[model samples]
Target: MDQNSEVRLEDAGDGAYEIVGTRSGDRLGRVALTGERVTVEVVPAARRRGVATAALREVSRLTLRDRERLELLIPWDNPIALRVALAAGYTREGIRRGTPELLVYSRLASDSGEPAPRLLPDLPGGELSDGVITLRPLGEGDVDFYTELHSVPDVVATSVPAEPKPADEIRRRCSRAATQWLTGSRADLVIVDTATGLPAGEIDLYYQEPPLAQAMIGYSTLPAYRKRGLTTRAAQLLALWVFAETDIVRLVAGALPTNIGSQRVLEKAGFTREAYQRQRLPGPDGGRLDDVQYVLLAGDLLAQASGAGTSHA
Candidate 1:
């Protein structure tokens, strides 16, 4: 539990777990356990300081010590609660079909107290470098370069979906990239040329559902930065990191049938073409597009002659 001496969970009788500050004796929050569900409420004054995460973890420990499972059903719009729930090591099962507004999460005695295996964990310092190309978490600062890349013909043909995203929408996506990393939804990273220290491209790891041991990757290189093998290097670095740092055993990517250049990039990175999936991706004009899937297994990556590289951050 966090904030140990700063705050403590006091059992004020009648099943009420009051979170009180040790210093000022102020009521910070409360953890209520009803049936199999666990709920936490934090006062506005004491928010965002790890109090809620600590309380929820303590409650889960106390409950799981006796039973097998602990549960949390936070509202769909409550991002703060969701963060706390995740920090406290809850697994997001799914949203209830009958109650779509609620996002369901649960903790079990058998579950390791780490972040859910399905959620992508943040990289330390959010960077990876091989002394040449550097990969760092994409941020709002990359909006200009990100928008520029989307304008390239090859990028548009290969990565852009049927309907192009508007400028405002692209900016919004760039802004939310970091938050997505924190939430473990995705890892959006900008590829930087080490010599020039300029944003050269972008890559992302999209977490697949269910068997959390699988993930997919996507990439786009700026027109000015292509033909230098940076995309291939980024893919290799990311695959190495995933295999070394995460349980994801299979990393995959896809490209259009005609995008032989992209296919070759994946090939150079040691990803094997697995299938010619017909109409696997959404297309423009309400149709579907075929994709050639490429895959790299964990054993394949781990057995490679190289390493996950280093972080220059």
Candidate 2:
């Protein structure tokens, strides 16, 4: 059915639903809202087309009208439910720690007029891109790609997670990308070459504590994509997205003191060299390593975009 179709909840004994068409009531898939904690599920066929979002908003509106507050305790790993909850105006309060971590989201009847504000907003359309490259959140399918990326000697020497990560660990990180984004932990994105549509490299934005006013950038390009400036462009794209969508005031990045190429990429991406901090990064060995830090402010990006700033970063 089209997005405009008028679908309403029907009483099938409880708060259960079959994704039926609005006009003639032909079916699509089933949707159910079971008791108390407000959990929702829509079968695969009828998913991601606003079905779950609609169900959640309706449920919250009705339930909160009766009670003072409505709360949802979502499994930390369940990305879809988390999205639907936030979309339906639920505010993420915190996490409930236990055997399986449960994210706590709540909506109040008093929270009216304006829409709910999310601390960590979901990536729009599940990806970001420029004409030359694209960035999509890491997933389990990227396990193999990440393993190969880490195996590259040059990449291993320069980037964080300094040495190669075991395949199992890579798989776990990929699987947790969604949950991490939902919790404002980190955003790990796989870079793709637009022309060939193959995975080119990886870039990530690591958010800081509490206010989230600061973040750091890290990226690496595959051996095949090097010398082509793909890493710089990807960094620029990420910086722009953060400045546009977030309230972050500063974006920081650091490179090993000897890695001139890595430093160049950040500079070309509009970051200014701030300082060199001794023993700032964890070494591949048990020792600590020096880092050359770079900083980029929101206004710096704006000046560059408007052509009012000098070319030098």
Per-candidate TM vs. native?
0.73, 0.80
Q: Candidate 2 — which residues are off by over 4 angstroms?
A: 1-5, 10-36, 66-68, 98-100, 113-115, 118-130, 157-161, 209-212, 305-313
Clashes of each: 0, 0
Per-candidate Cα RMSD to the true structure, in Å, reads 5.2, 4.1
- Quote the lDDT for 212 in model 2: 52
